[model samples]
Target: MAAIRLLSFLDAGPLAYFTPLGAMALFGAAHFSGYVKPYAFPLLALFISDLVLSFTVFAEFRTGLLYSGWYWTYLAFALMTVAGKLMLKEVTISRLIAATITATLIHWLVSDIGACAVENKLTFAFYLNRLVTAIPYELNFLGGTAFFSAIMFGIFELAQRKYASLKPAR
Candidate 1:
C-alpha cells in the first residue's frame, strides 16, 4: 500500500492525471477476497494521496484535503474496484488488459463530471470539450495503469513461484 501510494505521488503533475490509481484498485480488488476492506485499500490510498498533494504539490489548486470533485472522483475509484473484481475475477493477462481499458474509460467519463461541474456550467458542448481536452492525460493515465498492472501481477506471480506458501491452493 505504501509503495502504491508513493508511486502515485512520484509522478505528480498535469501529466499524472493518469496515475496508477485504476491499476492499484484493480490489483487490490482482484487479489483480495473480501467485501469491505478490499474496497477501502484503494479509496484510502487515494484520499491519503489527495491529502498529501493538497498540502504539498497541488496546494496551489486545492485549499484543503477534501475537495468538491472528491465525491465524484472517489465514486469512480470505488467503481474501479467493482469493475476490477468482476472483470478481472479470473486474473488473466487478457482480462487485465480489458479491465485496464474499461476502468480507464469509465474513470474518464465519471471523473470528468466533477471537473466539468466545478469548472464550467453543465452543458453538452462543455462536456464534449472536456472529453476532447482530456485525451492526452488519459493516455498517460492508461500507460501508467498498464505499466503498473504488469508490475503488480508480475511481482505477485514471481513471489508465488519463490515461495509455495505464497501461492493460494487451487
Candidate 2:
C-alpha cells in the first residue's frame, strides 16, 4: 500500500485522490484479530507514506513532519478502520461495497471539514464550495477504494481457501 501511494505521487492529476490507504485500513481491520495490529500497522504505513510524500512530491507543502491538515486524513482512516471492524465481520460483495462507500464518505467529510477548519472559514458558502469542488476527487477516491478493496479481499479469501493454514484459527 505504501508503495502504491508513493507511485501515485507520479501522477497528481485527475487521479490524485485515488489511493489504497482506505482499502489498506479496511483490510487490516478485517483481517487482524487484535486492536493494535489493525490500527497500528495501517496507520504506520500511512504515516510513513506521508513522510515520504512530504519530502518528495509535497515538499513545497510540507510544514513539519507532514503537510497541514494531516491529522484529518489519519482520522478518516481510523474511522474507516472502525467501519470495517463493524461492517466486515463476514466479508462479502455487498458488505465490501457498503464499506467502500462508507469509507469514501468518511474521508470526504472529515478531510474537507478539517480543511475548512484549518483555513478558519466558518461560513456556509465556503463549506459548500469546498464540498462542491471536491466531488471529482472524491469520485476518484471512491473508485480506488472499491478497486483495491476487491483485489485485496478477493486475493486473501482465495489464498485462505487454497491454503488452510492461511485461515485464522477459530
Best by TM-score: 2
Candidate 2's C-alpha lDDT? 0.87
TM-score of each: 0.86, 0.93
Candidate 2 structure quality by residue, lDDT tens digits, 1-170: 78777776778787776778888888988999887888886798889989999998989888998998899888988999999999999888999899999999998888888889888996789988999999998998899898888899999999999999999887
- Candidate 2 stretches with Cα past 4 Å from truth are none
lDDT of each: 0.79, 0.87
lDDT of 1 by residue, 1-170 (tens): 43455555566555455466778888888888879876887787788877776666666677455655678888888888899989987888999999999888878898888788877678888988888988877887788788888988899989989999988769
